[model samples]
Target chain A: MAQLTLVQALNEALRHELREDPRTLVFGEDVGRLGGVFRVTDGLQEEFGERRVFDTPLAESAIVGSAIGLALAGWRPVCEIQFDGFSYPALDQVITNLAKYRGRTRGRAALPVTIRIPSGGGIGGPEHHGESPETYYAHTAGLKVVAPSGPAEGYQLLRAAIRDPDPVIFLEPKSRYWTKEEVDAAAAGRLGQARIVREGTHATLIAWGAMTARCLQAAEAAAEDGVELEVVDCRSLVPLDVDTLSASVRKTGRAVVVHEAPLTAGFGAEISARLMETIFRDLKAPVLRVTGYDIPYPAAAVEAAYLPDLDRILTAVQKVLDY
Target chain B: MPSLRPDQLKELYRLMAFTRRVDQEAVALQRQGELTAFPPLTGQEAAQVGSAYALQRQDFAFPSYREMGVAIVRGVDLVEYLRAYRGDWNGGLYDLYAHNFGPIASSVGSHALHAVGWAMGAALDGGGKAAIVYFGEGATSEGDVHEAMNFAGIFRAPVVFFVQNNQWAISVPVARQTAAPIHRKAEAYGFPGLRIDGNDVLAVHAATAEALERARAGGGPTLIEALTYRLGAHSTADDPTRYRQAAEVEPWRAQDPLLRLAAQIDDEDFTRQVVEEVEERVRDLRTRLLSAPRAEPEEMFEFVYAEPPATLAAQREELRQWHS
Candidate 1:
């Protein structure tokens, strides 16, 4: 076990995969020499050489479209989309080709490709830099979406994503890149399991990606007020761990879904609806949501107000508790 | 440099004739309501067959939606290939790995990058295999095509970009698609590009063969723009008379690719035998396609992923219960 930041732990995971799997390749814009903008892939190119780790043209569609082809040709490709907002340009390829290739070929072909996107806001970057795009991928049928809240999950989940037989949208929380934790390199974790970050009986705070950290903080604050809030870190979004979520929500009897994406049609709505459908009789209060406003992610100066912070989460938790 | 012998030339003509017959039959089937719609490859037979024929067994071909001739030359089962047009499946029901042919990509120019990427893998594997991708002049204007060509040039991927410039993207003319020649687009990507008489089987075969050889020899990618004409409507549902004049169609009809190849073969007995064979095969195909089994509703839940999530599995069970 070694103490490492999320970015460093992810780099360690990538190094292990590249060294172990000869068919694995890592490539994207600036992923070769610059080691990625966040340096998540730092020292990868030098260690693996340009053949295994390389840079691509600044075209997002080709980056993903070609990855699909490479996967068809019996290669495991782990590509990056730079940032969350820029992922929209490649949405056509992701949805049309990567997500549909297996079904289109009727299981004769499998694209074991992992698309890494440094997702979500809180760093106060420029416009189009800090946006929550996980809902788009989670809603896609053929894709497996996962976002690690901290270092340990980041290390294990990325390794698992790279090894899965299906396409995985690995959303790396950019805001949590610097958070440190001890990650065991040999630890094993499955893709579709949810982790309970905090134990409480009053209510359940369901969140993923960067918002999970905020939920944990809210749980800490609620504990001080003697209102215990259980935080469920939804590591995998597509193959959602509904059993775990239902159990947690049933035990608490109150739930508040949180995300950085806008409230309308966001993934929060899906979770809320799912909870109401299952274990509706077990609930003591109605499920509420704490999410961003239904508008374009505002400029960096006002992004904090747009994103769901600890105060907003606790407010939602209080509302559910009162209900 | 890749000239065809007399026997190979005869074989090429036979494939072209078969493609034309199947295309016509598919159109007739669409008119009779057996198919949802069919894109006729009437005049582009030589362009599709010649280029696809140049590929070796180790090579793969990526085709656009209207390349029934290419699919024929690649040995894809004709009835299975038409399943997409029949609305039986998303692409078609065929063994892609066995035929070395990709699914019919309906989205224009999107699969160009796929060919390049596949070719890059071949290069990485040190296998002397190449990939050929088919598109139309209109597809050249897509952003994916530009990026695909650029990536092929940069990586020197063993790929041949075979553009069947069939003169019409639905109602839009080739002139509206590009001001400069479509072949010249390769020059911007740092590769060689050429134009050919798409109606001439010998020229089409020779150019594609040469490009494939160069790609296999690590000479990088080449772009071939075969200047053909859409002798029929864009699809069974389209009305070409809305935009183009009858006079324009008359000239292209005279320059039909099959007619040009038939004139070159110049053997009445051989042409008759080829036509008889093609008609018999088309009849068999029609019978098989009409009797093909409908897909199961549960198939929608299957093949979405190697392991369906709990939510999808529950939904699938719900659907089964409803049916029960």
Candidate 2:
């Protein structure tokens, strides 16, 4: 076992995938010589050569669209979108083309592609650098969207996404990329499934990526105040492990959803709606959400106010309990 | 080794002619209450057909909606293609066996990115297959197109970006699209870019074949701007006469790709035979298309996902019960 940051975990997973299967390719802006702005793909171009791990032009649409073509030709491509806000230009391809290909082809074709996006806020970065656009892809019908909270899960889930038959939108918590965790390579196979990171009986806090860590911290903090919270990491967003989530919510009799995406049409709404429908009678309180405001991701100085942190999660948990 | 034979060249001529006739038919059909719209590829046959014929069976292709000619050359049935313009489910149904030759993308320049990504994947898998993505002059302004080329250049993806610069992006000319030559955009992305006489089928064929070969050999991506013209309104929905002079259209007709190729075939007899065969094929395809099974009004709700959302499922049930 070794302690690794999320960036190192991704590098390890990519290195392993490249060695095990030559089909995996890593390329994007600054990913080659710079090993990515976040260095998640650091040292890959050197290890694998420019052919497999190289830099791309500053075009997001081409990055996503070309990945679809390459997959059709029988390759598993891993694309790096530099930041969350920059993915806007590639949205047409991601939503209209990449997400719809598998279903449009009706199983005749499988878009075996993984798009790695370093998303969410908290890095004191400039505009167009810190935003959450995962809701757009998760709202899309055909894509398999996933986010991992820590180094171990990042390594495991990335390998799974590369191996999966369908297209996977892998969103890294850019804010948490440098956060370290003791990762067990042997536990990599357990990545795709959701986990009950912490168990409590009062209410369930469902989250993923960076927010999952915050939720766990919130749950721990809430315990001292006598509000026992259950924290569940939603590892896979698309093929949502509804069975596990529903069961947990049913046991706890209360629910609180958290995410960094805008609240207007974010994924938390979907989860809350599903909970209201399936576990309505079991709820002891109204399901609530602690999410980023329904506004554009702001500058880094004010992002702390916008992103759902431990305090926000606890506030929502307490509100739901009081309800 | 040349994959194409003399007969294949003749077949290319026939396909190009069929594309021309189909353009005329689609215009007539739109006027006769048969279609909602038609994107005519009237004067750019060589750009579409030659690039299409250059592809091998393993190669992939992505087309914008106006590329009916490319679809025909890539083995998609002309009738099936019409269904797409007609707004039917069958139009979305793709033929995967012919190397995933499918319908055109309606979202302008976005498919160019899809093409690059797919080709990059092919290169990674050691498939040694190339991909060709077709777009228009207007599409060059799109961020997706630029992104695709950038990625293709960096990764050396086996893809060819075929831009049919037919001069007008629906009344916006080449000057509105970019100040720099479109081919030069490829150089900015680190690949060789070529501008060809798009109306010359021989030149189009030679350029595409060379680019495809370089890609298959893992040399890198290529960008080709096929300089040509749009002889008709952008689509049935447009009227070019209001924006451009009629004299501009007159010069392009003389440089018509179909006629140019028709004059260069090996023999006069073969050229004449190809003309008649194309006419026959067009007539048969038009009839088949006109009578093809229309999409059921309910089919619109199907195939959004592998399984429709529970809400959609409920809505479909509601529609079914209401109809019943």
Q: For candidate 2, give the lDDT of residue A92.
A: 78
Let me know the DockQ for model 1.
0.84
The DockQ leader among the candidates is 1
Q: Which lDDT tens digits does candidate 2 get at residues B1-324?
A: 455677777888888878888889888988998877888988999999998988888887888888888888777876767777776743355565554575567788877776777776677668578888899999999877777787778778898999999999999999988999999888798999999999998789889999999999999999999999999889898999889998888989999988787777757887777668877887897788889888765666665555554456767888888778
Question: In candidate 1, what are the lDDT values of residues A152-252, reduced to their tens digit?
Answer: 99999999999999999999999999999999999977899999999999999999988888998899899899998899999999889988999999999
lDDT of 2 by residue, A97-154 (tens): 8777765664566777889999888889899888888888888876778998889899
Assess each model's interface with DockQ, reporting 2 decimals per model.
Answer: 0.84, 0.44
Candidate 1, residue B139: Cα displacement in angstroms equals: 0.7
- Interface RMSD for model 2 amounts to 2.9
- For every model in order, the fraction of real contacts preserved is 0.73, 0.67
